[model samples]
Structures are given as structure tokens and as C-alpha cells.
Target: MVGTSEDLHRLFSFYWFLEAESRNTRSREWAEYFTLIRTQIDLFTMDKFDEELVTQSREAARSKPLKFWSRYRISGGALA
Candidate 1:
């Protein structure tokens, strides 16, 4: 289980990467892998980590506009 904010941040980043990859590839295998990872993350947060910290880390990862833009380029700067 993750024990610190840094670890949570790393996990969230990985989660984001997996999710993005699953979307970009449109593969069932990647989608399943992302779902498994998400389940593990949820279990860890519920069983061993602080809820607030997990929430904050998830929010931080989701709110990174630069990361989003770099990973996915949309026409006319629209969101993906």
C-alpha cells in the first residue's frame, strides 16, 4: 500500500498513463489492465491510505493541463 503523498502521486500518474493508453489504443487488454490497476488503487486507498491524500493526488494528476495536452493533441485546443 502507498504510505506517503509522493507514492500516491506516482501511483496516480501511473493510473493516468494507463487510462490514457487504454483510450488511445482502444484495446480490450489495455482496458482490462487499467481496470485491474484501478481496483488495486481503490483497495489500497480504502484499506491502508488516507482518503484525503488519495483524493488530492488524483485531483492533481487530473488537473495537469500540460500533461493532458502533451499526451493527447486535439484539434483547435479542444479537450479530448
Candidate 2:
């Protein structure tokens, strides 16, 4: 479902509403992709993200024709 940056952002935008539904987003690949996007989107929307930060991230988010940053891998830490 999420193949490009625009796709990712849309998924991220729909994020909170999706979470409220308790529905799986069909594919694990897309789901993981959206998770990262969600974090970025959340940061962008949040006051702490800042204008400068948002500007940089927005540019990055637009520039990268991300073919799914989801290799089923996160910057490892604890599993939830």
C-alpha cells in the first residue's frame, strides 16, 4: 500500500484513525513502512518538531522516492 513517500505520508495521516479501528493494514511490509512514517509524521505535527526540523524532514520526505524503507527492520531496541 505504501510504495512511495507520498504514499507513506498518506498512510501516516490516516494513522491515528486506523489505530482506533484496531485493524491490521493488510501487509506487514506496508504496516512497518507506515510505522516509521507515523513516527516522522507525528514529529512533524507535534509542536516539538519545529519549523526548521519540519522543513528539513519535509524536504527529505519529498526528495526520497522511498521504495518502502521497510525492510522489516527498525533501528533495533526493545520490542515494544
List TM-scores for all candidates, in order. Answer: 0.68, 0.32
What is the Cα-based TM-score of model 2?
0.32
Model 1 C-alpha lDDT per residue in residues 1-80, reported as the tens digit of each score: 52877667766766676666667655687678878888898787767877788899877766652454346522233435
Clash pairs (backbone) in predicted model 1: none
lDDT of 2 by residue, 1-80 (tens): 21444544444435543342234455666666666666766665555534554455445544442334322223332222
Segments in model 1 whose C-alpha atoms lie over 4 Å from true places? 65-80
Q: lDDT score, residue 11, model 1?
A: 69
Predicted structure with the largest lDDT when compared to the true one: 1
| Best TM-score among the predictions, by candidate number | 1
lDDT of each: 0.67, 0.46
What TM-score number comes out for model 1? 0.68
At residue 60, give the lDDT of candidate 1: 77
